[model samples]
Target: MTNATAPLDFIRPEVDRALQRFVDRRRTAFDDPDLAAVLGTVRDFLAGGKRLRPAFCYWGWRAAGGADDPGVISAASALELLQASALVHDDVMDSSDMRRGMPSAHRRFEKLHVDSGWHGSAVQFGEGAAILVGNLLLIWSGELWRNSGLPAESLASAQPVFDHMLTELMNGQYLDLLAQAHGENSFESARRVALFKSGKYSVEHPLRLGMILAAQSREAWIDQVCAGYGQNVGIAFQLRDDVLGVFGDPAETGKPAGDDLREGKRTMLIARTLELASPAQAQSVRALVGDPKLDAEGVATLRTVIEDTGALASAEELITTYVKEAVAVLDAAPIEAEAREALKALAIAATTRRN
Candidate 1:
């Protein structure tokens, strides 16, 4: 058999090229130097991603008997733009300083403000500019999807899924904010946030959109495939991310070690830790998890507490369970054999990645 990841590797360059062409075309529409800087930032931001969403969409189309087509690849690439928009806005909201080993959009803009000696507060200017950049990416994602050179009827057939995916993503972002503001840390709340914010848009909706576009309508099996395979794999993917946020390497993840803990993200891993922790351990985590000024020792202390409480183990078990569930679904799915193997590989890759 071909390498497990060959399918994803095959599509990545195609998607990147599509993104470059789209951005280049957009560049021709604007002439301002400041706008050029914004475009450059967007281009750079769009450069780094796993492209998992596009991979899922592509394989979904293939499974539905869609032949190889550049137009399909173009449509799939739009998901990367959507992903970029989400990340830029997420960094601004979280006050994140770095992403993919570079200064985040807001921080970059903030630096520009400082360097230019702008009159207003640098922080506010950075955040405002970053928000506008994110909005531009979101708008561009839609435009790209609509103008991907696919037939109008096929695009229309899949439009609702795309619309709903965006809606769910926004709702998930709000839910994440609310979870933090209200200090809601239940497993259920964490799962809900993961489902809307990342999981649906990350996997289920993308897959469904691809299938719908290929099949030219929402078929019965498409819904089953998404529900059975997409949901479980997506949630598992997020759970793995929760583990990485606390434990992943900075070199691999492209962020500071323990950055998510510093930002006080109410992730499932944290919720599970609190659930299983001793009173003293829970108190310690509560004191340390959200401290923006947390030092290496503080991070070490939390890591010990999470390990001692067995939350890490529990999270791993859940991740394994979800992936197993997804694999079982894939085994029975009527997808083309090659695509089935590719998706199974993707499920493992998504859940077990270091970054």
Candidate 2:
């Protein structure tokens, strides 16, 4: 790897190369062009991300003094493959048309079906393709984890954490779909969803996996410290995402303005808005939000309601509190100095990231 000229960039290219190499190898398993599209589409879908999970995992390893290990980096990279599966399946579940400012995987396959004049409903073909691709990525995520060149014993130790992470992720998805279906309008429910969906799976588990890989029988307090740190930071990260989904620039967020509102996502922001907004404003918003055909004007109307209700500031305050708590966890954490500073920067970046 040539110089990427940044502390975090050092790990990024290695992860990217691993993903690409893994994808290339997997492509060989399919000889037919149609079958090969699944691998190709997944590769493209995995191209862009902040790679926060992998970074957290890597930094956690460093915190445990397992510095500069190739096996750790490769294993950490596997989290991205898991993330790709989550997002692809998430898009299918949400029926999202776009991802990362491009056509979503399902949409791409749907277009492919229409352009090729293939048999059966284009929607069904597209959804089926996306679901299969998600499953393939899930399968590959495990393979990449196992093939990371770590000692068999060390990898074995991380197995339970990895398995639990996957289980929580799926359960969280079910909760999300359930909440959406029933229009359950509770802030507590949204927070629960965030805790399982993004907090545990995306941040805490990956960080813990790194620590476990580093020392299968490490100190208990150390693991507790990292878990607490990751949990708070992860929740703050997702809340920030909720903010972006509403107020962020479309070009940067890879979604339309107020996309969460349009989706009627029972996010904490929405719940807060509902809690704080006056009865009439709340009534008007409830009427307009989640309308698939809601125009920009309607989005504006809802944005004003959110602002007027003080939900945005409330959310920001919550983020600040969590960041402070996360930082406080590091004060006594049994980690080396250099890696601790790096982790601090990551906490800031994950919270402040624009995309």
TM-score of each prediction: 0.98, 0.96
Worst 10 residues of 2 by lDDT: 1-10
lDDT of 1 at 220: 90
Indicate which candidate wins on lDDT.
1
The residue-by-residue lDDT of candidate 2 on 252-282, one tens digit each, is 9887787787787888888889989898988
Clashing pairs in 1: none
| Worst-scoring 10-residue span by lDDT in model 1 | 1-10
